[model samples]
Target: MTAPQCPVAHEVFDQQYMRDPYGTYASLHEKGPVHRIMTPEGFPAWLVTGFEETRDALADRRLVRSIEYAGEDYRTLPLPAEFSTKTVATEDGAEHMRLRKFMNKSFAIKRVRALRKRVVELTDGYIDAMGESGETDLMTAIALPLPITITGDIMGVPDEDRANFQYWTDSMLGINTEVVREAGATMLGFLKRLIDDKRTNPGDDIFSDWIAWTDDDGKHLDDHELIGLGFMVLLGGYDTTVGMIGGGMLALLNDRPKLERLRANPEQIPDAVEELLRLYGTAHTGVRRFATEDMTIGGVDIKKGDVVLCSMGAADRDPARFENPDEVDLDRPNLTHIAFGQGPHYCPGSELGRMEIAIAIETLLRRLPNLELAAPADSVQWREAYLIRAPKAIPIRY
Candidate 1:
């Protein structure tokens, strides 16, 4: 395909857009499936908002995840050597498959199912500690701690070190460069110690399994791969699940009628969870992919090395793909949303994420029938991250 001159970039990441991204997406969708937009970081990229376009772009092999393919103008955070290893998100083709295959076993359906009882126990325990709640921040009380603890257990992080582990994770996500670098180094050191311990004394955890796993050719993950994979799993499962839980609960609590329906018939909680993900999945955009060659998406000419961001947040709620796209419909006929993304790069931890959200919501509905927002819905604050969509905190009374 022949490439055309890039279109004028649309400015769409301002405060208004962050506050009501769905509204911003709706406006973008009305304009076209794909758009040339200036990211908050002051770089030009294509934002695919149409459901079909986003789905097709996600599965498109020509759009790759590696930073090497990026245009010179594309900017990204600098990582230290210890944190620069190729991970599932950074590799493509066979290497990606190899990494994904190894990680998949840890989150397989049966294994995730086995953790259901434990998830319920943890959820109940956290809520119990809330002391029947007068008013509390749901993010700390349940959303953040639950996933942190669960993913911590999976990584075999000792109970005493979990607080420090959480701190490192939070610091790594902060905006300060020095803090991020320091946190990355500290976290890498901690993970290396944990890996060494697992090697000497294996356990029923993902890290130990990665340490023991050998491919058909008797090849094992090298030190770099092991650390990279461990870091990815630990961070990936924590922030995204926390966002989903907090966002999903906010969606329910905002809608009294639908919330009541689920409470009346707890069996429908799974379906409600799907709808919640469709509307409020934390991954606002798929990982940035650079075009390997000139291509056309939704009629927009994308040149080689141009950065492309498939907006799952926009696509899943596209009115054309979904009827009444803005509202949640638990009985919605088609639940196959691209919130977890699509194709080979689709989220490996999807089953585990679904299980966690379902269990958390179900437990909340059953235990706290009177749960309500402590403040007006509009007063709730949302995190100002371009890649992630979640509330900064959810104040509630039960």
Candidate 2:
């Protein structure tokens, strides 16, 4: 009889980890740079801990990021075939490159820089709204909507459809419930129509650019590919920036001095953004890569088809790379965290995300100098889903 599998890891639930995964991350890293574990939802996975090793493993081509690479037995995992084929996140090798290349032109940092003024204006509006409320749940009221609005703005999603996009993103990023799945269908349909509209009547927005985009080979995005890319971007753009603004707010509020520091020296906020990203940084829960060939990363013997889950949260706290890995230091140098997965999958939207978040925080301080958390930190409700982590509600008083 086969013995029960004892995967080497610190078994953790999503809620517990979501609430405070740090101590667990620290404890797990002690076992080795790479830890084999099961998630709260009973998913078999490995979490990479050391920063360098984590970065290297993310780039390892042998570990294909999709259900298909795991072969027939992977059917036990319950992934739909359409999901396996349609999304760039699930593609590897030439496919990943092809999908990413079509997007590169529209997502350049220059394009992000061009959107700065509009982002600032949106930030101003959110702040204005928050001021009227006097006390507000920063996550929902400001942090959340800023990125959603920005993404809609970039993609040129109609105003009527923007909030529904946020709802779909929340579902996709968190638990894949019926709400998420149904909303996803609606969103996909909408993007397909949007892409068609762009094809017929093109505009300057990134979505329009994507709809008309071609790679080096003169290939364009198919409908399914376009839908997948647009879906991924909405979640990616909204969540990372939302986390940055909301999570960064929490981190800064934890220190009145940090709050005042940014107010006094706005220049410090840029570095503060990096430090915030390092600490409360996101894009944390990402896809599981199945090894295409037997290989070792971070000194672990990864068998062919073994699933490796990349946890930026654990990697960001690697003590070997960052002194007092758990602490957030605005002045830390040579800091590179996996907030965006490194290598080929490095987030294409980093510039726009950072700019929107920084401007939000900067504007928040400027507009509401007297802001403080309305509730204690522990009272904040966090997201419990496996794929992404954030507070469900973050209340603050001005």
Candidate 3:
């Protein structure tokens, strides 16, 4: 006989819940580490909010990303069929290892580290475009465009094709299933064409590097797999960075003392970046996993085939895990946070993303020493999407 789930007396996607989720999550954490909740997608799921529970569950091999391992009811998500077939997030075991290996090679630390100069140049270009501005939406002027342009350039996307790329990326990141499917298919088609171009005109970029990578048997990722990989790189790094940089800047702007501290010590940008991510990282929906077997987490029973959403935001703010969970402590120890995720699906672009973020912070503070929010923090709008949490526009004045 199985134990019944412990449903919380709260809603996950309540309008107030979406606007500011930390306090609500903290309250939920007090009730229990794991709660039975409905996903924003309307699926019944287990939500793990405790720090230890989230870390352990993330590392658990029995809880997988592969939809094939999902229970019959869980498999009925309204996603496109192709979503379950490929992509790093939907794979498990040796197959996931294979895709991860390909990605690891393409985004090797050395390779990403080498891009620092180019990233700086790109960052500077965007700052230059700001032109000592009176006011501008940083989300548009800097935060959003920088990563998209960089990802586009790395993927060998031509300048003329970038607007379409951005459109598809925006559409795909939304909560609407039909919009996501249509945008996904469109992006995949565009990626296929881009990959075809790389086949003939290889260059010094990630796409070209992937084109050159081949496994032992003289085999390489087929066109479909390549398309999946391309989508993974582009989508994975885009909006997440946008939210981090934009929300992160807003966080600092709202807290002038810390902003001054960081400005006084530019070298602290790295630590500040990590702290910001821990506090204000994107991905409110968190990562989803399907249980391959019955499991007990945080003293709660989670049955096999149960869908789990690990709240990275809640985990990072867990009082038991950090000394000052709510405060932005730049001097905090380099404690591992699941902001970039954990285990097999850890973000491949983490280092690159971190570099971009650090550069964004340092560049902004240096170039626009008087930079401040153009509007009240409460008045700024946030995107209401399930997967990504970010402000629609971070209005800033310098």
Between 1 and 2, whose TM-score is larger? 1
TM-scores across all candidates? 0.94, 0.91, 0.94
Better of 1 and 2 by lDDT: 1
The C-alpha lDDT values of all candidates are 0.85, 0.75, 0.81
Q: Candidate 3 residues 1-398, lDDT tens each? A: 22234454246656767677776777776777787887656678888888898988888899998777677656343444454467777888888888888888877889889889988998889888888768999998988888888888777889888777556766876667788778877776778788899999998787787778886666787776777787787778777898899888999999999999999999989988888998888865565789989878888888888898888888888888888788888788765678888888889989989998999999999999889998998898887665678888988998
lDDT of 2: 0.75
- Clashes counted in candidate 3 amount to 0
lDDT of 1 by residue, 1-398 (tens): 32232344444777777777887888887888888877765678998989998999999999998888999889775555545547888889988888888888888889888898999999999999988769999998999888988998888889887887556656666445677778888888888899899999999999999999986668998878888888887767888898899999998899899999999999999888899999999988877899999999988889999999999999999998999999988889967799899998898899999999999999999999789999887788887666776788899999
Residue 26, candidate 2: Cα error in Å is: 1.8
Model 2, stretches more than 4 Å misplaced?
1-10, 40-43, 71-83, 175-180
| Residues 1-398 of candidate 2: C-alpha lDDT, one tens digit per residue | 22122244335544566677777778667766776676543556666677887888888777788666674334233223334465777787788888887667668878789889988887788777655547878887788888888888888888888878656666655544555567666766777788888888888787777767687788777778887787678778887777778878888887898799899999888878888888887667667778888777776777787778777877888887889988768778887778878878888888887888789889888888788988898788766655666777888888
- Give the runs in model 3 whose Cα sits over 4 Å from its true position: 1-10, 75-80
* lDDT, residue 235, model 2: 73
